[model samples]
Structure formats: structure tokens, C-alpha cells
Target: MNGAGTKRRIGIGIVGCGGIAQSHAAALKRLEQAGECTVVGCADLVEEKAKGLAEKFELPSWYADARRLIDRPDVEAITVCTNPPFHVPATLMAAERGKHTIVEKPMTMDLAEADRAIEATRKANVRFGVIFMRRFWPGAQRARKAIDDGKLGDRLILGDCILKWTRRQAYYRDPWRGTWAGENGAALVNQAVHALDMFLWLMAPAGQLETVYGKWANLTHPYIEAEDNAVAALRWANGALGVLSVSISTDPQLGARITVTGDKGATVSVTEHPEGRFGLNDVWTIPGEEEEMGRLYERELQEGREHFKPFPIAHFWQLQDFLAAIREGRDPLVTGEEGRRSIELIEAIRLSTESGAEVKLPLRTSTWVPPTRR
Candidate 1:
């Protein structure tokens, strides 16, 4: 069995029981029945919480500590779903045991932790992938291809990524929801990470961003340790630049979204709603090739409907790629290093906000924190 558990009997372990864990379990459930995987066990700080998830998903066992679970002889792979601070250790520990890993985004809220995760996976020679599942977006891929083909014409990176979402006090009602140490920073890391990934994915092959200037404030929720909203200006090496905006205190809690612009034309938006019908969709206006682009897009749209069936099957694509990479011994779509870039950039934005200067890319990672409870 393989990483998903059966036919290849790859043992699987989960290390967190937070809200996102449910989605992970559901996806695992479907994967297992299809003979793509099996869940040997799951773990969390709270044993019963992990027990509950295992029971719901019908996993064979559960543990209070991830280390114990990873140490299990049966486990061949692990999913680290713990909060920001604990992500590094959980991931590194599993990798050290020579097991494959699937880490949640912003891997950690800081560059140092992210770097460590990247290096550990590389050194361990295991299949490591980041969960920026937005890459699976149908429209995102379409937009990326158009950009690569120069359909946008001498395009400057992107002018701005306007992410206007609404979240009320209730969303942050849980104290852990908005703390610097707990959730890391607010809008940029938590909310904008998805947007930022899509931002960079479309702008690939361009030089890494060299400078970042950010302005942030507590905004509506002063009780929280992190900013409720933030905006950062990004300068790519090619002199092309972009701006990002995020807020968690807005009204109505609008779903996550991104809008990109170029010199020739624009694709108004990109969103990642794994449960949604259109895993990815795009609306674009190619400068001199509108007719051809539209026709192609229409065909893609029709095909997308047939492929993205309604179910909690979003991660199947990402998980399949990881499994294939593990089987083939290669890097998956989002490598550990590629995954860490977003965190590095986010850190630069945070630092720029704190230091009042534009930080450069390939930024140094210092003041690293190992996973530990406050």
C-alpha cells in the first residue's frame, strides 16, 4: 500500500484536529475507498479531539502526541495540521523518520521555520509538498498559460491584488483566532497567503521580488494581537510590481478572491473554493486575440464541468500528485522551497511594516522558533 494506505498499504497519520482537519479527513475517506490511501492513525494535543476525528473518519487509532503517532511502524506518511508555531517540529520530526509530508500553508508564519521545513524534507529525501491547492484552479492554470504565451503583451507583473473579504468579530470570536503568536499575523499570512500564492503562480519565470513596503494597522479589532487588515507593495526583479490588500474585519465575510492586471489585458479574478463546482474558473480578455482566447476558454469551461464533480474531493488532485511524485521519486507541483517563498515574502512584508523599509527577496531567516506551547 502507498501513502494513502492500502494497495500500496501505505500507513497515514494526521497531526491536528482543528477545523481544517475535517476537510482533510473527508478527503482521506474518499481516497481510501478508492484504494488510493488508508489512515493508520491520527494525533492531536488533545487525545479525545484526535480520537473524535479518527472515529468520525473511522481511522484505526489516534494519539495525543504527533511524535508517538509518527513513530508508529505502520505510518509511511503524515499531514501536519497543527497551528503556526508547532508546524516546524511536527513536519521536521515526521521527515526525520523518513516519511512523506503534506504541510499546511504559510508553513509557518516566519521565514526561519519555513526554511527549516524545506531543508528537512530535502535532506530526508521524502516527498514534500505545500498545500497551496489554488494551483489546481482551472481558471488559474488557464490564466497562467495565457500569461506565459505572452497573450498579455509585455505584461508588467500585476498592478494590484484586491482581496476585499468580510469577517465580523464573530469570526475572530475565538481568542486564538487573531493573536500574533497564535495565528501569526492577520490578513497577510492568514487570508492573503492564498491570494499571494495565486499572485506568484501567475507571475512565475519572472525574477523574485526584490522589495516590499507594507502599511498595516489594528483597524477594527484592537483586542487582537495582529492587524485585522494590511496592504503590501511588491516589486519584482523585472521592475514589474504589484499590490496586495486584505482585511478580516469587513462585513459579510466575502469568500477568498484575487484580481490580477497586466499591460495588454486582464483576468478579473481567481478563487480557490475546493468544495465549489468550478474548482477554478477564469474570465479573460486577450488584447489582439480575444476571439481565439474566448473560444478556448469556452471549451475549457465545458470540460471543467465534466471533470470537477461536486464532492469533498478537492485535495484528491494535490494528493494524487504527491503520491505520484513519491512513487516516481520527484518533486510534486508545489515543492517545499516553492511553498516557503510565500512565507518569506510575507515575513518581508511584516518586517517592512515593522521596520519601515522595503526588504529584499532571498531574505535571511533568523530568530527561528521551534514548536512549543506558550
Candidate 2:
């Protein structure tokens, strides 16, 4: 027990010593200072990378094999930071060891894997979560509340998600970067998945998405095996319609935006300008609060600039929620099922793109394959 009360610091292990793991490590360090958790070890398939992350974070141990890290009795929980393909296996390993687990998003490559991971954790009786950190942003929460409070009106008529970000050729040079075998899909599944998740989250009140029609192309980066641009049209059960467009081929990197409009003629939107910065409520037209949009934007922008360094503080907030869930014996804010929703939506779009037909939702099966590019 590290804290003053009966509470104890949760023992944490980290799998995958990659760039994303650095953010988890930094957040864990802050949690450790608050007496919330202890980072006992880290692991990666490459021994040198494991050792490097261990030394950098001053964790107690490092291992080339993740199983060794998960088997440690002190590691009560672990964060699976591996790439999409490895996410399911790592989650299963942690669950088998009776350790609480949280995985980085897209959650798993597809619906089948996501289902397996969810079932494994449920059987093992361990808490599980997925990192969709943007949901922890205050602005996002405010937007959700506005919808729940019916401030956006009775019927959400239109929703749109636009992600125009840039990535260099060097980014695809990695063996796994632009491959169907490694990443499953490119712009839609890899980079724009975050925006897609945010889009789905904000539009949930509109009712379930009924169908999707999509198209994908490798236009700019012909050297890569995956598409660098994609677009989708969505229809909800409640009659709300949506458009989603994502691309990494843009020259200036315009970031992402998710906007929703209701029947009463009010609209609200969140924008992540320049991509990696925090999302702010850029457009708010809910009655008298119209004039407050500028103030709110500037205020949130300054807060994000101050707190986003050493990695986005959103990670810290979400990780804290995971740890609290572990101690309270409850599910995390972003549960495995919640995370699976985004993967399901992504898979629907991919299937529509492959068949050149509108895909009906609650996808009957996960047999859809990525479209082969020449």
C-alpha cells in the first residue's frame, strides 16, 4: 500500500516499447508520483528496444518476450501498446495471467479478433479498456452533454467527419507501415481511426448507423500497398445522414473536424487543427452561447498548448480512469465493447469499398478483406 488510506498503487506492466509506449510510460510516471500505480516492467520482441524503454523509464525489469512480463506477480495490470495485429494476442496473454488490460486503438484489426479479446477478458474476470483518449477531452465531454441535454434539438439531421492530414514517404518505409498484412488498411484504419471513433461517439445520439457506402484509393502514394485516401457515406436508423472523408495525401495537413446539426437548426462541431493538437469546440450555435464559441476556443487552445507536451494529457486522464476502474472493481470508461463499435464501423466501410455496394450494418460476418491495390 503506497497511499495513506487502504488504497494501494496498482502494479503496471507495459507491452511494446514503441513510440506510443513512450506516452504510456510518461503518463504512468505521473500516476506513480500520485501514488496511483507503479510501472514494474516493460517488454518488446526486440531485446534492445525493451532494454531501452526500461532504462529510459527506470522500470524494474525488461524482457524480449511479453509473456515473461505478464507472468510477473507484481504486474496487476498491463497496457498493450503493440501494433493492431498483435493487440489481440497480448490482451489474451494478460487476461490469462489475470491482469487487467487496456489496448491501444483500432482495438484489434477486425471484428472477430475484437470479439475474441472481449470474451477472453470476460472469462478471466479482469477489467479491460481501449485507448480512445480524445473522449477524455473536456470539449468532447461538453459536446456530448449538449446532445444529451437536447440542446442540439430533437433530430440530428446531418453529421460530417473530415480528416485531411499528411504523411511522408518515409512513414511508409517501415515494413509494417503501408501493408495490408501489417496495418489492415491505411488512411481509414490507421491514421483516421481516431477521428472515426470521435465521429461515431459524437453521433451516437442520432441513432444506430444503418448502412455505409465507401471508396478508397492509393492516388498519391503509389509506392505503398494501402490506400492514402478514402471516403464514406453513412445513413442512420433514425434518418440522420453523414459523410466521412479521410486522406493523408494533402499538402498542408488540415487536421480533422466532426460536425453535427439537428432539426432545430443548431449545430456544434469539434476541430483538431493541425492534427495532433487537442480538439476544441470550434462551432457552437446552441442559442445564446453562440458568442461564447470564440472565447471557448481560445481558452481550450491555450490549455492544450500548455498541457499537451510530454504527450497529450488526455492519455493521462484515460489511464487514470483505467486504474480507478481496477481499484473500484468496475469497467473502464471506454470498455472493450465500446471500442469494438469503431472497428465494426471501419470494417463496414472497407467492405463497402471492396464490393462497390452499400453495406448494411451489424455486419453479418468478419470475412471482408482489404482491397488489393496495384
Q: Top lDDT: which candidate number?
A: 2
- Which parts of model 1 have CA positions greater than 4 angstroms off? 1-9, 154-156, 253-257, 261-268, 271-282, 287-310, 366-374
Q: Number of the top candidate by TM-score?
A: 2
lDDT of 1 at 188: 69
lDDT of each: 0.72, 0.88
- Please give, for residues 51-160, the per-residue lDDT of candidate 1 as tens digits: 89998989899999888899998888887777767777887888889999988776777666777788888899998887876687657776677677776667655656
Taking the tens digit of each residue's C-alpha lDDT, what string does model 2 give over 103-148?
9987876787888889999999999999999989888888888988
